[model samples]
Target: MTDFKYETVLSEIVEDGVRCITLNRPDRLNAMNRGLIDDVARAFEDANADQKTRAIIFTGAGKAFCAGDDRREHVHPTCEEEARDLVLAIQRSTYAIVLNHKPVVGAINGWAVGGGFEWAINCDFPIWGESARGFFPEVSLNLFVTGGVSSLLPVLVGLNTAREMLFLGERYDATQLQAMGVAWKTVSDPELMGTARSTARRLADLPPLSVRAMKRVLNATALTDLRRAMDLETEATIAGFMDPETTRRLKDF
Candidate 1:
């Protein structure tokens, strides 16, 4: 199969039937902007369509995995409509990752916060480096998690742990994340990508049809219907963004 095409924020390659999509915004800690989100969605779509690609791995380019949304772009007018739009965009990005039929593993090397944390949570498996840290610090900025965090977090780490993470807005190291059931395993920083690639290759070696079917079955319980979940998440996200309080908080940040 042909390799996927990507731009500044994304890099794609197919190796051993495993497609690797790397977030390439190292200068900004690989923070998600409009370009990154667009590229990521396209990359996932492309990977899913490639018959040779049985699994996918997502990682970052710099010292950090993703620091969430670009703060520079987020500083804007405290308008309800604009906030709603921002939320919808975020939901779309998250849904893209979750709905992709191929198995996805998030190789978190450094820090993943806010929307980044939400993105990692949506992946089928989360493999972290010893230095990796994850958290939902949106509350610290007076903003709430919008990218299916309400649904995914509770399922991944339970209601009480989710509440603590959301409420405290503190970072959790890889060890803590593993304890909370959010991280599948922690590897040394140098082995992070290699470990993830090996894991993806192993998945790729499985019967593709059966693997896909299994994923569908597993997702059915967490996500009743992929399309329906996406729709609801999109609506809730937009509403949250359009809220007066949220608008004000976003503007202040």
Candidate 2:
């Protein structure tokens, strides 16, 4: 972490062993492009390996936690390899959080749309702000959810609820996600960072080895399906990316 100077994100370790990683592209509402995606993967990898950091708190720097992928920079791949690589980069970034030995928490300051929702949900759990909005505009935009959400989301919110979010490309506020039993807590915007850091510190105070073992066991059992679903999603996304209909729809949107 010391050698790398991150451009799309900022990282600092707090006194209580909680490292805060704030997505830094405020002008773009902290949207995920290649740089942000790579930085996230690298940051989480470093945080997990850092003995001084016991838990991580992820948030965004400006009005939004993340506005999702930067669509203006989004690419439509011409070949299968390019398509798969693009999707895989995205997949790896999300998986990096899961791969961490320490617990990860998201503090959603505002918008968490599309891939942003994936990032939020990928954390062990998320503490959201009251003003935060979550949604998947992917279907309309001719894209698919990049993470293993195809498997994980249905488990949290039920199949029908997942369908509403995925198929219909619907929006859900923080309160609604909290009610659905997805979000950990909903705090006022001003309390977002404080609440997130407090929670991370609490988690960091647990027996370190036990916490790591617990996470490993939980992931092995709970994420078995997620691994398979992510693979399928990647393959399908690449094929879909080249579809004429999808291309036309993407351009229209």
Candidate 3:
């Protein structure tokens, strides 16, 4: 893989040909600040272009996989222009991951809240740690989810279950997510990295062209509405950020 440097993310080649990109913000539980968001997007884009990178394993450096957006860094947008810009910037990470050529495996270690949870689902294969937890707190926070979740989620779990998850913003354990078909596997926290490495190794051993073709075909078939969902989410999220109530709520938090 190419030698890439990032402030909020760590990238390295591991497991023969797997690119391990770690979200690095231990003090903030790997929150998605603008720097982190941009770093993630760049890392995936670099991996996509690097012929040596056969697969990717995404994880967090600290306890939590990602705690959504960093309240301090992601200030509430004061105007429509700011909100639209922020929404587009935030969505870049999703586009990078979903559109990448190589397969991605999420090593979800801990909390995957809000946008963090959306990213986990965006992975081609998501392997959760036993203690991992996921939830959508966007509705409660006067915010909205992105990452094409509006379309991807309902397919993983039925519309009714998806409604419960999104509308209620309830937390679900790793086992629960696996049962819901959102997680490909749930392993003990100690085994999370090992499992991810093994999974990536298997993917790396496959014929690159065949694997890429299959991924493209699958995405084309199942995610026909992904772009539409992302557009709708961007609009909704920008509106949410522009609301004065959202600013007030964010301040209180």
Q: Compare the candidates by TM-score and give the number of the best one.
A: 3
Clash totals for all candidate models: 0, 0, 0
Ranking by TM-score: 3, 2, 1
Pitting candidate 1 against candidate 2, the one with the higher lDDT is 2
TM-score versus the correct structure, for each prediction:
0.88, 0.95, 0.97
Candidate 3 lDDT over 1-253, as tens digits, reads 4378999898999857888999999899998888888888888999899888999999998899999888878766668998888788878888889866799999998999887898899899999999999999888779888999999999889899999999999999999999999999999999999999999999999999999999889988988998999999999998888778887777776
lDDT of 1 at 213: 89
Worst 10 residues of 1 by lDDT: 1-10
Clashes of 2: 0
- Which residue ranges in model 2 land beyond 4 Å of their true spot? 1-4
**For residue 226, what is the lDDT in candidate 2?**
79
C-alpha RMSD by candidate, in order: 2.5, 1.6, 1.2
Residue pairs that clash (backbone atoms under 3 angstroms), model 2: none
Instruction: Residues 121-229, candidate 1: write the lDDT tens digits.
Output: 8778889999999877676655567667777777788989889998898789999998999898888999999899889989999998898888878877776655555
Itemize residue pairs with steric clashes in candidate 1.
Answer: none
lDDT of 2 by residue, 67-98 (tens): 98787887678888888878898888778887
Which RMSD does model 3 reach against the true structure? 1.2
Over 4 Å off, model 1 = 75-81, 225-236, 243-253
